[model samples]
Target: MSERTPFRWHIAVFLAPAVVIYTLVMIIPLFATLDLSLYSATETGTKFVGLENFRTLFGDAHWAEQFWNAFWNNVWFFLINMAVQNPVGIALAALLSLPRLRFAALYRSAIFVPTILSFVIVGFVWKLILSPIWGIAPSMLAAIGLRHLFEPWLGQETTALTTVALISVWQFIGIPMMLIYAALLSIPEEVIEAAEVDGITGMAQFWKIKLPLILPSIGIISILTFVGNFNAFDLIYVAQGALAGPDFSTDILGTFMYRTFFGFQLQLGDPNMGATIASVMFFIILIGVCLYLFGIQRRLRRYQF
Candidate 1:
């Protein structure tokens, strides 16, 4: 009889490279960051300070104020995306999924174009377009006879964070749209036809049958948006700079961490403090993910389509 092959080793060999790479890049840095957060810098040199860094982050009034400001700003940023992005994406996906729609392929491609472009390009373009002095925003508003409504949105403290959040929603809406479109497409034609025969047509068909079936996709997208918004940085950084300025009104957790790690302007860099902030962010993401996986996702009944 031929010798039996080593099944476990074969599987391990294939997975080895991926596991190694993941550990080297993601896992190692995460643990390293956690370790760094426990230490503190002193005039004598780096020394163990246990939870002192975290205490400074949350207990010290000077640091706590900035921390909370960024935290709330991040929360607002996330809420805007949840309110605007997901629903708009679902609507677009539904429209695009309709049978016999003219130029459906073209429409999908056009709608998704912004998603493929780098955040840098989108940020810079919007920055100029929203610029009060030379931007097309004022001229466009003038053409529409609404010039009085145009403002330097990116430069104003009251509107800066919200404005950037909207900009991000515009760029990334295609992701949810595409995910939902695929989920919609996965639905069996026979099921829909059967519903049609039962007097479920058009709006009723969508609201009753289609929407319920797609809840899982929507849930996944919601969680993704939550994580993405909490981790947001590039668009805000590129458009508003490291200062996240107009007096830091636009600062979110990602920018907060960046500014802490590398330092900006008068602030000196402190890796230990930066790591504590990062660890806090990591825990926030972890908790959010756990809530979705255990709390929300468990309640969403998956229908076999």
Candidate 2:
């Protein structure tokens, strides 16, 4: 019988620093937050309330209204990215992957540069650009004779959330594009040659062959978008403030938790309730990932070529 290799003590040594840092920053805080959710502050001190906070969040009318509003907004935010960003990304990737495409790298870099920029910067810059008073959007529209279409989009309740979501899409579309681009490039040359022999060329080739093989990549991008979008805070906060205003039309779970945990203008901070909100967000993300991993991923794997 073959003997097992000796334990790699050096491997553990190399991993120790990263493990320690992650535990300190991520793991410990996660557990602490979860623990904090079970208690509520009292005049005397604190009281263990079990799931009472969660009940208040969902059952109480005031909290329920805000919670549902934030929840629905978050859902819309994710849906926009899924519908617009990913499809556009796929299209861009298909074009960039074309063999004869010129300056593909330049196009890729330009598109991807926004993804690397700080969300705060992107949000703040867009906010300034869209300002009704002195912003360039009105001027740019007037230049093209479309000035009549201009409005205070960022300040309007009806358009504010959608505008922010599209801005997010514009900034992050490059991620799915790059990921799918890599997936496309990884397709075996032999497969392309075989498809060519079969007279499956151009869009027909992509629709049937490339698309099927890249379904797994799309699935991965979708899940990542879900997790990231659900956890999104920086951009919305930067553009709309802590209240996520225009009458809280842009508030998502992250912002909701932030306001609850940290306090806003008049709302006093309630750490226990805030922790409950955060816990709920964590579970929402968890369920989503699990659904994708166990359910959608299995189906995606079947289409892998």
Candidate 1 residue-pair clash tally? 0
In candidate 1, which residue pairs get closer than 3 Å at backbone N, Cα or C atoms, i.e. clash? Answer: none
Clashes of each: 0, 0
Across 1-305, the per-residue lDDT of candidate 1 in tens digits comes to 39886567878889999999999999999999999999998899899999999999999998999999999999999999999999999999999999989999998999999889898999999998999878599999999999999989999999999999999999999999999999999999998999989989999999999999999999999999999999999999999999899899999999999999999889999999999999999999999999999988888865544
Tens-digit per-residue lDDT, 1-305, candidate 2:
39888898999999999999999999999989998999999999899999999999999999999999999999999999999999999999999999988999999999999999998899988988999978599999999999999999999999999999999999999999999999999999999999999999999999999999999999999999999999999999999999999999999999999999999888899999999999999899999999999999998887766
User: What residue pairs clash in candidate 2, if any at all?
Assistant: none
User: In model 2, which runs have C-alpha deviations exceeding 4 angstroms?
Assistant: 1-12
Highest-TM-score candidate? 1
Each model's lDDT: 0.94, 0.95
Q: What TM-score fits each model?
A: 0.95, 0.94
Model 2 lDDT, residue 63, Cα: 98
